[model samples]
Target: MGFPAGLLVLLSVGALPCQPITHGDSAKQDGHCFQVLPAEEGALNIGRHWGAATPAATVHIDMSKVTSTASSFEFRTLDPEGVIFFGDMGDHDWFVLGLRRGKAEMQINNIMTNISVRGGQRLDDGHWHRMLVMNEGDSVRLEVDDEELLALGHVSYPIIERPVPEMRLAMGGLLLPASHLLSPMNTAMDGCLRRWSWLNQTTTWREGAALRAKAKPCFSALRPGSFFPGAGLASFRPADLAGGTAPPNGSWGLEVELGIRAPRQTGLVLAVGVPDGSLALSLVLQPTAMVVRLGNWTKLRLPLPEGPCLDAPLRLRVSPTQLALQLGNHGGTLPNQPPDFQWLQGTWLGQEGRLFIGGLPDGDKTPRPQEWGAFRGCLRGIRVQGHQLDLDSALFRSDTIWAHSCPGAHEGAEAGRRARGHGAD
Candidate 1:
């Protein structure tokens, strides 16, 4: 209902004076003693610093109807120790709202018009309030009901940083915490988010996935190859593998070997293609490596070696039975595997009748952290053991038993989806 009983409008130590704008006070005056100020001028307006002592209760000011382009709305209160806070203090937190996308068209934080109102809400308490903020482009007005609370044309917000606005558009809802911005809030609202509506009712899912237990391996992603530019590469042309089909148990193979100056650790991702274009796989890596398989994107975390020695490279040899992972120094052999490591095997990459390697299955590339050490020595070759189930030589050409596909040639072919046991060079 009304602001918690003793919510006082604080003023700076040398500012005008501490004034408590009560709910019953008339709000039609300019600097009226108990009267709240206009939509453009108030003791909390920019250039006027204010502070007050607050009890343990939460405090919130309703400024949902002011449209002022002034700097910022500033207020402060005393800490429990009686220390005076400068502006909007106590365990202060605030969020400002630009006009909604349909209400007013604005993408970034830059003020395009000269006079507009940016809505705002300030809360020192723990409860929620029906806060509103209106920005008229240049002037921003903050109010409660129609009562003009803080008419701020210009308030200094030196610490607030606005991004370049490349993500999905969202109505602004910032929460300023007691000190600086709290980290937990960032964790809660960090990803792409949108308010649900009738038009967007179809979009309910967020991050993460619900995969079946038995999907097959359908795709592979490798860095430092022709498929990927600048130190990394990935490949999944539907027509290039054993099963060139879009979905339904298409057999696919991928191979990656360390070259001269190769990375110490490399990440890998595998997806299978099923009737609905879904696939699955079991992943493995050394102690120095990390992998993330979430939704359609599988991330590989490769930590480069400290200092320098010879080159150490890792290779993945794909076969129907298992994935042969080999790592060695320069031209040497990889270390021993755990006795039961060979049992860590399964069909990789089968989801939604489609497949993804390192990123999203549909190829929506989101940048994740990846690093591979530069190789000092050269890598000789890679060896895979498997027979192509499909006899079509065009899709399964291999000098070695492991047939690989041609670069950029696996876009779409019905035969690749049905074939089996073909490999990568």
Candidate 2:
């Protein structure tokens, strides 16, 4: 069968007014309405904007011809995490291509092989990159710009051996309710994708792509840290976390470093312990005090200095012998605290390996409200255990967690406000 003949498109929304099918509508002679419209001109812009009303920006391509192997695409992004494409071959064999920690990644899975390869980091500097992905005998090869991936960057696999039936490249993320175990950025992308060429498939990008949400006039996304309104929450268990569960009890250690700007009086800033049990460790802000609870036994409340600039650098470190906290030079350390909170030595963090930022809602409410009210503040640039967390790409987040919502944001940075001309130079 012909390439385009086997191809079918499934984008979400109508990008334009009624346009005739280039495949030619059979009902045109009868003067009846037909389906579809032309693709947006230039690079296709898509994002990971999620809600009950906001569907995924998914693009599906047919890749069942095993004899045809080469494919290429061009990309540019400011986001460091988000699903770019998830290909399902229907036999539990699949592949994902996207950005992981600002580096290009390709994860392949088959019967006996499950491996990942990463490219150079910091690829998200709003720069354009050309990628070539093709089969190299028993392994898959990936190249960025024109440089071949290094030795550890290629994997032995069965991808080219069998046909690929179904493949999806969501503009910004994976089409979940799927697995996020491989790529943790199970969220939307803040970037642009264009000039996709797959296996000499005979079709224009316009005709091949299934447009979802209107191709937004791309903009510079304001990522001045995520603003968590009262009653907001974001949770995740990163895939890179070793072993997928809490580590050995005695070896358990935690560190939290955050730049906080809390204008509100009371809010739960961060919690890294059992949700319902008394074994929780939490950081809560109340008017003039920053209270840190280490389990149910030790609670330290430090009064805030009276002044403006409701902002402070907060750091919390937990070890076997010491509980260290620093809030803008106003915190004290408690030594030999492990014996006080026995739960600290054995299981400071539960087996779930979960970390919650912001407020947790009660399950009894219709649209669940916060348990002890919410945290009305912003957590800027959080680093936990030496890893930076991307709030926009969490596994789950409350509706109120937002960007460009923090007060004093410059409105001039909004989408469609500035002009940017892209060149491959």
Candidate 3:
């Protein structure tokens, strides 16, 4: 019931014996900085080598000022021009951790197989985040802010198969050229890095004065709700509900406020339907639009304007005859198409199925895989059938209620109600 022995020792030992590498005032957050490698040249070499003899390693980085957008590979390491950890082993056989289409990804190539795991949220939101990458035995784990983003097992092949090359740790820029066979490494990161540690060794700006001078102070606060704490948001299926059904009958409306972090990926914000995947109403977020699927065939796609919606509250309304979407003050509506069946009528929510929010339900009424469009943002103030959902209910808490209060909740809710009424027939 007490603290673990290892944890207690770590706490009692205080700081590691590694020399402190400081620049300017270490006490001031903005006073410390490290520049990103230039697009074509430049790198901060750690001047250390890891090989078969040292197959297990851990890296920690404190990053601030990430760009809003990402290149083919968001953050790369191990070479002057951001080649993967071991580019000499062949591009397809190296271990890489970066962003793929805005999502954090950890990829491992073992000559015969390529394995990757993507995080549920985006990591390039101009915030200060702590990243940890660990290679222990046959597995690799990538974590952001202490949350496990991705983990891969049986990845010991590369460390064992490839010859140990003289490789030093580097950040940003790519050593390889862009080609169809290889993923493009367009531009390096535009951010500040602090307190990077590898295998218990820490590096600071003092070690690289030139790079430190080029880095500007970045005091921008990280946007809230970028990463959910605890278990994050809750997801539910019909069976999870008390009655095994919901929204029983009458002219009911569904409303929810979502803080979208990544709009480029497709995700299921909410769904109500049967066990066989037949949905009465399904709301999805696409790269540039909000898609509403009614019944089986009717679909409404509302395109979002070209701009950043990160942390922007999106309100959605699903009524008997129409679907309304509001992002901030911008709103749009599309009438429910014809051939309306019982599923599209008032009592559809009572059907023998489930209600899923922040994700889709699988056959057994559990959260589906991320590839199946799991929502990647914060959800709150869910109202269905005129009843505001008790997000703090025991059932939802067990399912992970990371945080509450969607961005601009009061305004967004008001706008949602107004937009829902204004767009009605």
Candidate 4:
């Protein structure tokens, strides 16, 4: 899931580490050959041995996220300058010094204390070359894939307290000339610097969600029959109220409220219905609104209105056994028989209705006189505080019935009925 940070350079089979550091006679061993330079100029060569290639690609080493300790960073490449070989037996050119710091002036005799080789595996033929740099204590060891190479002592300047955690970590710089042989695609030069750390830490984004900054919520503006200052919220008239005033009578309506996370998936689902009509309260995912079912709770069966009457001023008439629906007269009804344990038996939001009806249908048979202070089944207004519904302002009239005969008592009811009949004709 994660990648290391470094640029990998390409090297051919028999390219030089530093082109200027020429060899006398070249020989091969273990399926690879190396250019041999005499020991006479070995010290001098080591000092002048600047990495040969100025790789075309660059790899970024992100020190902030390192996870590997014994990790090996390899670059298969050849410097345009030349090649320098290194090995233990001195008989085989097992590795190439792809990168190195210039030799320093030492006061001691024949002892190069500050000399360090930071490269790996060499090339024998004009083929793939490998360079490995490994971290060991305060120093890095250079080696070929399988050969034991020399270990150089490290001396850090005051400016560089820790191993320069972030060296340009790049390839194809001005110092090293570009390789000639079919080198790796400049973009493919990749490598990584490893560090020590746990990978499974929660990022800031995930932490915020877990901390309740982004919590789950739900709302039904259309169901409660109301609107914000913007557009018409859930508009409806008295005639659209579901569970008609008369027994076994029903009406339908529609609702268009914003649902943060609609109830299509899980949780307690509730829908608003128009008066006794075919369409009951159903959730319309795309367009923010609810369709209604038109029927009564009869042993788990509720019939639905049909024929796609997606117009204005839909109606609902609810009865004890059946709920009827009249959508502007394009009479379409849906029937769904509620189960014995139906908490949300009927409700609706009026989108496509002649008259919008707003109401509450809680299972309360009778209450004390004082409790009857508010009305139900028709929403006149709702108060919102801090973007949340204020339960205190939710008014409900328990007895102001808006049935077929006395539809004018509620707003939008009479007009909606006329619209429904006209819609059918």
Q: How many backbone clashes does candidate 3 have?
A: 7
lDDT for each candidate structure: 0.24, 0.52, 0.39, 0.23
Which regions in candidate 1 have their CA more than 4 angstroms from the true location?
A: 1-227, 230-233, 237-279, 282-311, 317-324, 329-425
How close to the true structure is residue 344 of candidate 4, measured as C-alpha lDDT?
25
lDDT of 3 by residue, 226-319 (tens): 1221122344443444433444553445565554544344677767665564557777777677777766666777776665443356777766
Where is the poorest 10-residue window by lDDT in model 4? 102-111
Q: How many residue pairs clash (N, CA or C atoms closer than 3 angstroms) in each of the candidate models, in the order given? A: 100, 3, 7, 127
lDDT of 2 by residue, 100-161 (tens): 67777766665646766677745665555676666554556666788875333234433444
User: On residues 324-358, what C-alpha lDDT tens digit does candidate 4 reach at each position?
Assistant: 44433344444545531132233322333222223
Q: TM-score, each model?
A: 0.21, 0.51, 0.37, 0.21
Q: Tell me, by TM-score, which candidate is best.
A: 2
Candidate 3: segments with Cα more than 4 A from true spot: 1-233, 237-249, 337-341, 344-348, 362-371, 385-401, 405-425
RMSD to the true structure for each prediction, in A, is 25.5, 12.7, 18.7, 32.2
* lDDT for residue 206 in candidate 3, whole number 0-100: 24
Residue 390, candidate 1: Cα error in Å is 18
* Higher-TM-score candidate of 2 and 3: 2
Worst lDDT 10-window in candidate 3: 3-12
Candidate 1 residue 113 C-alpha distance from true site, Å: 66
